[model samples]
Target: MTSTHATGEIQSRDRAPGELTLRAAWRWWLPPALVALLLALLCRDPFAGDWDALDYTVLALRGAPSSMLFGRTLFIYTNHYAYKLAHALFRVQPEHAYLLFKYMVICESPLAIIGMWAFARRLSGSRQTATIAALLLALSPFFVIYSGQAMTEIPSLVLLTFGLALHLRGMQERQTSFVLLSAALLGLSVNVRESVALYGLWLVVAPLVYRWKLDARTLGLTVAACALFFVCALGPFALIYLFDVDGYRAAWHGWVASMHMEEAAHPVTPYNFLPLAFFFFVAAPIVFIALPFAIYREWRTRGLSPLFALALIGLIANLSLITHYSAVINGRYQLTGLPGAIPLVADFLLRRAQARGRDLRRAFWRVVVIVSLTALIIGTPFMLFAWPTIQSHALTKEYRARLALLPDDAVIMAGGQTVAVTYYRGLGLGRWDVIGTGGGWPGARLPELIDAHLRAGRRVFVDADARLWFTDSWRGAETRQLVALQDRYHFRRSADALYEIRPRTDATAQDEPHLERLLAKPASKLRSLVRH
Candidate 1:
């Protein structure tokens, strides 16, 4: 009898804490499904607005000579490399670049979701709570807004989350390999996006949450893991800089100078970091209101996941500070840290609701659900509806209509319409030979380069009224009249005056034989991107 009792007790202890039977596993699928549904709905509209920098980046990826642009930023290299590899493997088609972009988002987004689920499961200690946290991340309007872009933030978020998850797992199991894996992830995260600089620091700085106890050996091992991670992740870039000293110096100086100028100017007021900080940080009430309450409720059952909490606060606060210093208040820059933040917030809310057991319990849960649902309802329009509708959102339909009227195989002097031109050509709507001037590519020259293309009998498309490209008065009224009189090129009414110029003579026609050959290829046989 004594032996049987001992065996029974051992068996019970060995079983997992929570019973995740088939029914329970099925329930876990709910949140991820909802997340997928929401992202699909938002991406239904074509990506909008012409972001000039994005155009230049995409152009570089599409066979624009690297020698023509400066050395890549941390982000630029990752995005450029990813796109190039994807293109090479699949034979990148101009007509399917948008599809290619969509494939990247759809494929990489799951990493963040999985990361959130793992982080939540570890922190909350309940599969149910973790599922809710993962769902919240998937359903967030902020995430939905960014998931379809050809940007590096989402991938960065994935790396950070994965790193955090590995760290948590290592701590739980007392495993050295997991710790090293975490460090490797943190290293990769920093390179993937510079904003993850904060996350890398947090790994070193955040308090170590010891469930049991730690000796000097454990501490030393942890520090060694961090050092190894930094070396592994950053070694390649360091070597590149060491060998290419002049190039690295020039790129760094130019980048820092541009960033400083942008910060000093602070052109975007009202919406910059100072204001958004309230929504994300200081008002802490907005993002972290439930944190303390959840901490209190779980205090008896589970002490706060202190390291994760501190990491959350540090990453967010740092991002807000950086955002304030930027010229514009772009929310996407902080997205790399969001994979971890969403789950922390969600777990807090769910735990608080679960704690209030009897008195007004229904009302309390109702309120929690209402606020979450309200955030989605109110935030959706801003992220999805309004964003895509703005003329500056990406490229307005107006720009597309105007660009369509130009010759399909003409070299054009373009500065501002790189994004629009890229999208139109990538979509098979039209193809124009592009000679980009502004927005800073590697070998970008001024009007001298434009002169070369134009003098060689190529059609030129100046930014009819773009002050950034020419002297303020150059694109003024008289210039518009002069462009019209100069021959077959004229500014057609676009959504916002994106000019469409055409060849007026055959002398200009023969200048782009390569463009003619590409144009002759059927759109159907062009790149068939695997869209998500």
Candidate 2:
């Protein structure tokens, strides 16, 4: 830690007669540098988890309906476009989209590292504080989790960091382009993931609230720029919605309706964000010390920064928890606030060291840098080793296990894992009728669908639990009868102890003539809000 002025304004550092040497300058970047290298080496495999949604979206882009427009489109379609663009130019394979997505994600780590360092440097006016902030971000488990995976979380976070960095600079510089670019980036971030829109609100309001004396022209410019970006960003989605109005409505309504189901829900806990700091001694050790100190210091001097950042993060997190009752509360959600929080954390810790009359500033910095590197060395294996495997089970199984048991032409009567199923479609498995929830087929419609498929000679595969099947009562009988119809069908386990059934006999072939004929024709794609 190095001392700096109490105000959150960057000040020029004047080194005394005996400053640290050339080799010591390495401390500024070595931590993230090493983490990047070690992560690349340890986890070379395309991240297997949660690749489906992004992958499917990429696939959609390859064959997006001409009717597709932006706002009406889902994340899946947007992701599809990103990949399609890359594939058209980069000549990459679809299965390998995760590879590209991973690189894009990992690439953001360095950007985040640089941005945090710059933001901190601007605020605290201490190179050391900037370095500390960057190091903390690099070693954080939460960011690293998404950085190496194919999910949109990291990309969204990266854009957010970029937007905030630009917005902060815009406030200071009052440059029109900077403000417009910031607004555009914020809009882009929201397009990538709706949750990020919360940060956009933070960007727009926090500044006006904190610095109420803005000139009328600057304020007008900022507001106009933001409005322009918002309209442009949302225009495509709006068009897509117009083209597929009913589909979007159905998807939205179905999602809301599923909220009442008891078996699949869980509660949100605020304490869930602990692991980001708890796991890595290198990165989180600093955050643990810095976060509280920053909050306290900001309360005394820079009140709005802490209040705004914390409020935004806490609000987004709690909202996510309440709506989903999910246990996904993690540090990634806090990425939006990192820029503001980092400087506060850095300044507070550095001030304390100065107040204590510590002459060990250089040594403390070296230790912080060294420890950050060490935490990455320690944490990389778990991320590379355990993370992919864990994610594979959670996110990749459906993507990788397409050939598990079913033939390519077998019509699956299930929901979820659409991308994985589509990926494995090449294995000769038939397209899924996708009964239940986001598949566009509700459980209530399942009995008719199942009978229709059976009458058409289409071998319908169902989950052993038949969780998605429509029944007046919850009973194992429906699935049991369905299974019995197949004199010889294959059963294989899927995640969470569910089994998939595939026909094994000609009787299965003979019993459902109508299904075969209907399924034999190209399946019709009805526009609907797809759950990714």
Candidate 3:
């Protein structure tokens, strides 16, 4: 086995003698930036897609209260403050706040690209390898898609890659300040997205990978560093608790309970690893083909560098956590470790090209071209079709117009679109009764909740076609509550699957006939009305 430290050894062997000039650095930076800009332009949408996007948009437009800052407080605050700054300085109108926020968030893509370059360079000690890795990540379809959205994934990734880069560099240079800064950035990343806390495993395993002996002082320092990491991670939450003790405590408990419930709902099994496989094969085919070979080659050559070990550990930890608890398989979930994997693959490919003259070098270029084209081909359809289709379901002007048609005093009962709907038509406009069906209340108690609203002489408008409430595939408590609601009240289709709920006694001759006709439709037909 090689005795020198992994990253330091690589740097000593491969890096150019002189520091990279501005012109050379710009050559590396420009491609990823241009690619990100092009993708952002193509995938730009005024509205948010999916539940989290909508929730984030609402939080950005309206500042996140203590109740809303469960896992992603920093990300929410970042967007919120950005919006506030734009509104104050740039004179951005309220109507355009989300659009501005979307672009601002999208900017993280280029920053992430640059961060990946720095990280990969630090790992492989080759600017060429780093550039290739950055471009590869820039072209990633899932990365491109998420980049143009108002979400935390890309920002978290940006912080994570940069933090890892600094940490690696600090270890290489023996700089305590760099290490401490890396810890701070990592902690902030945990605040942005709690999923990043998984990377803490990498930090713990890192010293051991560098072949540090398991002695008392080493163990004590490791423990102290980890303690510092946790303290930094929890610092924002601590401040939040200090300001709003009850609210923070309630949110924390609720988040923990939801996590438990989610864990129970999606128990870990052998099949859970399928998503990790899917991430490699479907999401990043190049990495799928290259990473194993890279690991094998590196293992045989230098006995597994700290860089390779970091990548492998990060990939395993992230994939394990996601598959164990998350019900859905998403490419974004794998992104935290994807940057790390890219460096290893890039280093391997570049090394191969250098070692084997002409033909193998041609093969390396061919692989890059093929992989880039494949990623674009796979991602283009999603960028053009799937993303827009999802965004269409957001609280667009059309949906808002339909909502405006309802009585001024009407209370909206929504499911997944609850945040968006409430944001558009909630207490700000004096309509404070947008009840979310996902309030964790019992289905049996749904009637009692509705009865109170009705007794107060407010008309209740239920989103009958909301996917959460009406999907036949869903057999959750929400669906049961919807069925119970149907059996108890006479539903008058107000506009585009929006139904006005009234008591059975209140059903006049005109209402009764319409209600009967609506009820006569088959279950499939009713579900067909859902926009999903």
lDDT of each: 0.50, 0.50, 0.67
Winning model by TM-score: 3
Residue 364, candidate 1: Cα error in Å is: 11
Candidate 3 C-alpha lDDT tens digits along 1-532 = 2212333343555456543432457776678768876886676554754457666666566665334334477787787788889889989866566677678768778888888888887777766677778877888776777788777778998998889888887767756677767877888888877777777776687677767678886576567667777877887787777776435677767867865665665566876566556555545667777888988877877775876786686567556654544524355676766876888887776666545443433644665676678787765654454553445555443456666778876887765556656656532443536776443433567788788888999898877553434333333445565656656777677777677888877755123213223233334331232212
Q: What is the alpha-carbon lDDT of model 1 when measured against the actual structure?
A: 0.50
Tens-place lDDT digits, model 1, residues 126-238: 45445656665565554665565555555666777768777767767778788778888777776656556556554554335554345686668767877876775667566
What TM-score does prediction 1 earn?
0.65
Candidate 1 clashes: the total is 13
Write one digit per residue (lDDT tens) for candidate 2, span 348-412.
65566545554436534654755466556765644554453344434434444543556555666
List the RMSD of every prediction in angstroms: 10.8, 9.3, 5.0
Highest-scoring model, lDDT: 3
How does model 3 score by TM-score?
Answer: 0.82
